[model samples]
Target: MNSKSEALAAAKKRITDLQSQMTAKILAIAAEVEKLMDVTPEREVRDFLRVTCNLPSSELGTYMGFGRTLKGSEALLQKARVTFPVLKALVAADAETRQEIVERMDIGARIDTKEIAVVRKRLTEAKLTPEALMAQKNVRLVAAAARKRSADTAALFREKLASFALHLRKMNASDLALASLSETVRNDALELREQFTDIFGTSRRSLNKINLNSPAFRVAAANDALKRICEGRFGNSSHYAGVKKWPASDSQIIDVLLLLSGHPVPRRGWVRGRNAITELPPHRYRLKAIELCAGAGGMSIGLERAGFEHVALFEYNADAAATLRQNRPDWNVVEADITKVDFKPYRRMDIDLVAGGVPCQPYSSEGDQLGQEDERDLLLESSRVIAEVKPKMFIIENVEGLLHAKHGDHVAEFLRRVAKAGYQTEINRIRAEDYGVAQERHRILLIGIRRELAGSFRMPPRFPERRSNLGDALLDLMSENGWTGAREWARQRRDCPVFDRQGNLIAHGVLASTVVTRRGTPRTKEAARWGSKGINIGGLPAAAPTDAEASKPGYLPGLTARMRARLQNFPDDWKFHGGKQSVADQIGNAVPARLAQAVGLAAFAAIRGVSFDWEAMLWPGDRGRLQMTTPALYLDQPQLAPGRKKPEQNVRTVESAGDW
Candidate 1:
């Protein structure tokens, strides 16, 4: 027995030794690879290692296998060099060649698969000659190339192909239809064909007749023939054309649609002539953006959708930082306390915009009005960053309370500090509902443009009409298969009060007010009771109403998952990562996507001198009428004493008829 025990111990020791040795070898290999690339960013090094080792692209899988996979085989390295030739060039070539290669690769990566599939299916259904397939592929490739290099030559090719496709789709060969299309699509097509014939040594007729359906044709096609005639050539446009022309014994249309389904369509198309080229107009002032207190990228998503690129994102929470990294590995997310971090990095980047809503605790109605000293006075940290970055524009958002806090002194001081930083400021009380969001959340938006650019900057136009309602946004989401954890919550509050013309209590369908985090104590007694029972409304104990309202039919428990989603302005298809509570926290913390988009669009338009209609964005309920009090004013006001003077009391009453 003793001999056996000794043997077992020896085996265990050997296993430990082997693990250590393996670990050392991996570290050495990683060091060598890092040195070879001359790259120092930890994240970049880690990503390179993963790609080198063929590690799974997902965070969970990569973490699980990181240790074991760090030491990749030499054969795998060779494969990587071939597969990622551009990356290899980046490590070995001259600066100009490396830049050119990287740009080309980026363009290649951005080409959407859906677009190619759509064109293929469309051509197949059209029954064009076999030659048309090559044309289609050529056009697709050219469009992809144009997008990547932002070149006019590629644009000309794309325009021609799109115009031809449009003409085919219309199927109106009439003089009027032809004229209409000629002025638009036909012209583009002619331009493309002309360009193709000029670029390729072969005549357009010869190039157009090739059979695209045959593998031999793809392999034998000349590079210039394929490149010039089609948008992109995997070869043989003629074979592709033949495939389309071939009779569909089966349901070709249905089959084509099915095949083309779920393909992503390109946002831009080429137009005919040098004058017809469409490009994003230059901004009057270049705007650089930075996100502060970024939480899991919700705000960043909206910002990007609005066309503003983030230079840096600051978040103190570890999990949220991880979430941001998982979604956008390229983003610069600083995982340190906001106060402790230096803002100099942003200054160095020449940031143009500083944005974030500091935690609302000290500014909330239910919290102690600690104005300057609140532990959450991180708004000052944001201010400090703004001062350091000296961006051309600064946007600070928060609960409406920030405006009215300290009887407006706090707000005034905040504005003063911003102006002192050489920016001209404008403050507005914005309702999310006014911006096509179904939520009734109100926020204080403080926009500051650099004094130099203030003259050209304008707020985004409002929508011409409200595009959604609470029911519109939530009903579909409440369906059984919609969002998880939402159906039960919806059912539970089926009898809550809904505001309609009549006094009748219908179901709660409209969005509720913003969900505030109450600190230290519950907002109401009911909330305290519910919190004690672990069933507080709105998912936060401090924000819930008192228990006396427990069985009351009109009172709603915190927002349903669908309702929360609507408030956050997330599309029904976008999903949250966590459980109901975690999702709720995310929604409550997010800046409504629609609001962000509106702001972005408006800024872009203003900077570019473009006209955008703003009147349409107001909700039907709010049309032609402003709310009685601005959100900032409402949030800043203290609870009035029972006998305190009211604004109405100060108004002079009109004389009676007898006096007249």
Candidate 2:
């Protein structure tokens, strides 16, 4: 044998022997820990190892976990450790599943971590056992959470105090569909301290004392304040629209309808541009944006319409990445797991906006409603990326239930964090109906402006007109396949008025139900049991077959994938690559492109310091009197407490329509 070959073999043997020895030593320590204390927690052993073995505390969990898994069984743990380093991941699987994985990997002479990792990933993805998912989920949650510091509560108090002080001063006569904000609710800035004390039982002075950092305190305060505003119980006075229902997290939407209530909505006709982003006047400057969680390019597409040039699009889904590539090959689409992708590289770029519609399940009303408690909640991650990118502005969209989650704890934490990070945030609870989408899907939008430009930034208010019906949204798509019933379905649904007065039919085809990601049809297992082969969904209505055999297959009407996608404001020209069910999932998960467009316009105006009379840019018929005839509760920079100095106004700032 050559000298080089002999040296290589010798080195490889050294590595193999050392790895085995280390695994054996770790197993021995773990077994000792287990035997010494019948109930010793892994953390206690971690500390013991830190002192006894000079092991770093950060790495103790791995050795302790290895011990907990196999005690002193060196051969077993040494093999599995290389294959699946995460002990919790292995333990989370059912015993049968774990045994199966071990048996499968036993084929190899040595533990091939790469090969085992692939099998582990496939098994985890296909099974998605809640136990296994949650184990990883918990670790991620801690890593993503904003580190708590002593200053967090102080920042929370200052933010709330400032918001309250400004709101009390701005609350005045405003006509709304539900109720009017009258003089009784409004307070003089100077008188607010005394009045606040007499009213909400806490003086403005004492609001700072309530320990805003306390989760319990923050939740209770938000609940009380929102409840009062929605129920017309603000300032210890009464004018609240008494909405009788369960204490929903977003009942505050009732107050939102009042706060920015605009001219009467045009109800009879269709809202134009329901399926497209409203094109605004061509602006000179094209601001740059970095899109996070850029699924299917919904937000990115909308931002493109809003005149923002995309510098990069970050998305994890391969299918979604393909969709973005298919549509805009020019866009720099980065397909990567967000947690691992380093944002430090883009810090040098002059990014003007950071926008994304993050996962909502963590705070969604439909799920466990875990809010900040859920590891899946990505708001903290978004904030982390935002800090890294340090954009001039950011727009984040989430489920309305976020405002009500954990008694409003999650949202308060979010706002406090934003304020502490030196950004001024404005939240708007928007109903998609008012924004040119057919569905009444309600979402909360949080727009943050860097503190320097905040004085000139104001939330764009709702346009009061209703848009086109569901019939209008999908009429073209349903007919694309030459389905004979398409016209009749749209005709019958459009003509007969349903529960909703205007803007997509609520029940019938007026407005298709919220085009969700999941189809309300049989699952694969259920279909198999029913002896059906390849079932179709969402294509013309299907009526029950008569004994006469008139109701043939495809005769009944259903909402098709294309039609649902249209209702979600995706242009017909853009195609979803996933076949049928996959298409449905994409459509359901997308942020209505049109809704995102409006949000982007708001950001555009905020960054450019312009009055977003952009509402007037909606479809000719749909833009109905785009005016706020009554006083709007939204306060401009001037109306805020005088103690705080306003940031320098930008040259682009407009002097008109300040009410918005």
Candidate 3:
């Protein structure tokens, strides 16, 4: 018993010592990073830490704040053994509050994140100094009238006015037909409109009159209506007698009004997730999907591997559509203008997902960044399809530029409409290299699921340890045409050290830069990046380096289409149907197959409310074969006799189990 107690005591002491050491190290790093900021650009310093030191950006600010707030207190902090999260709260607190927190720590009081949070909240609510706040013996409830109000009433009211205007635009004549108003209300609205017209100049048609569609008119009308309702100016008047008896067409408008009025409106069409089936339907091959802008079937290939069976693949470009059809003749490839496709017809088909890599030209930096003004922009059209088909979820892929402030209005409107369609949406940024693709391709994923499953979905876990470099990913393809220097070139690439923007080494091997559509001429910076990997970036090569090509004095091999495809994680067996330039464009525009598969698996798990053994399901095993397994509803159900059926069973036994 004494030996066991002594051992436990020693273990506890070691753990405590290690924790203090970690705290000391964290403070040391904070001081050094802060020192760097004095001599270096803030952004560059941040990037160096983020890439080279592997610090998450979310935690960067907290550590940086440590240098400012907790700078001369490293000894006290280490002695207190404060955790990082508690330090974060302290850093955010004011000097007086921080001093109080530190004093408590000095007395050997164990402070935690939640306790600090409560202390901060109490200080805020009481509007007292930290010492005064801590001196209280009993909890005292301050009267609302006596409490200081921190809200900006005018700014809040302006926000309410804007909300009123937006909500009014959502309503049509049918919504207002049964909404009676008193003479006072009508006169107030007219007065408001006159005031607005005076403030904002009238249109040319009528120099003194308000244009109905003008912003001034909408704001005036909405402001008048909202004010009257809030003041109860027409309470119990005949004007509002039939307001509750609105037509069925105004049901949505009613809900919108209830929300704007700060009234509780129960979520419509919300089915409890627990009640939904947790397994694939018995007769279905897999979840049915309709893909839009299916370029070269990259995402389609991934979804297929993730167990999705496409109902249709839509692509307007002829060569790309042809590639899909040629590669998988069994797929239903629809080569037509996606804008004109009638997705309403598929509403009854029970689609589980509507996934697409929407054209990114509208948001990409290489383009004009015209957003909705650009002819190729299909974001709203995608939203329309989601509304019509009402799939359980949807995934729209685009470049990160879509989230730029320049396109804020367009992105916000898209999210608003998607939310109105009974879906909860989130934007996620992911890197292809993090998912085992041999490139630094970053993509923005706009994912939406039915509101009931809002919190159920999570982004796929990253496997940075599984990341591959350019040489390892494409070595065989590089050596395909008997190039003698291929092995040496591959070795150089494999051994190259990758650096961050600040020139700090981040990794041991190089990753390919994002594949681009045009390879004809390389910019100076792009050329430099490729040159560092021992490759020529001028033009696409028709084939891998041959013996004759390698014999040239200064030849640096250019990547072939197959090599580029390999970098994009496309299978070697997959074939393209286009000429050289078109094939390059298709491959460059594709979502990396492995990255897409990871996302698809995450979406699948969320929608089905089932867990996945991600490694077995996604990672290819021996001989490049998938060791995929899916837990089915009828796995343990008794098999029926041949040619026999059971009417009572909800699950039907199949002759063979399906792969994930």
Which one wins on lDDT? 3
TM-score of each candidate? 0.43, 0.47, 0.55
Distance from true location, Cα of 113 in model 2, Å: 73
Worst 10 residues of 2 by lDDT: 627-636
In candidate 1, residue 504 scores what lDDT?
75
Q: Name the lDDT of candidate 3.
A: 0.72
Candidate 3, residue 413: how far the Cα is off, in Å: 1.0
Candidate 3 per-residue lDDT, tens place, 1-660, comes to 699999999999999999998888878888888897889767556655653455777778877778779888888898988778888888988877788788888888889888777777766757876676655422344434233331343334435434544454455654344232445434443554444344344543331254332344444433444444434432323444455422123334344334443544443332223343223223343677889999998899888767686767789999998898787765667788878877887877768899999999899876689999999999999999899988889999999888776676577667768888988887789999988788989999989998766787999888888878888888899898898778888788888887789999888778888887874577788888878777787788888999898888978888889888888888887799989999999998999987898898888878765555666555634323223322221222222112222133233222112222
**lDDT score of model 2?**
0.57
lDDT of 1 by residue, 1-660 (tens): 699999999998897676556545544544465463454444444444343343334332323333334224323332222222222223334334434433434455322234334444564546766677678788999989866775565465555444444434344324323343244443443454455555443433342355432322322233222232233211122324544442221122212222222222222222222232122222223245778888756566666544465656777766667666665554556677878766765566556578887777677665676766787677667778788888767778777677552525455455557768887777666777667666567787777877656676676655425534444455444443433444444444333445557877543444444554333344576465443322345343322233454446644444455556555765544455565456556666778876875675566544433443333321122233221110011112221122222231111121211100
- Using lDDT, rank the candidates from best to worst: 3, 2, 1
lDDT of each: 0.50, 0.57, 0.72
**Which one wins on TM-score?**
3
RMSD (Å) per prediction: 28.5, 23.4, 18.1
Once fitted onto the true fold, the runs of candidate 3 whose alpha carbons sit more than 4 angstroms away are 1-285, 501-504, 623-660
Better of 1 and 3 by lDDT: 3
Candidate 1: list runs displaced more than 4 Å. Answer: 1-287, 405-407, 481-509, 518-563, 571-583, 612-660
Candidate 3's TM-score = 0.55
Candidate 3: worst-modelled 10 consecutive residues by lDDT: 633-642
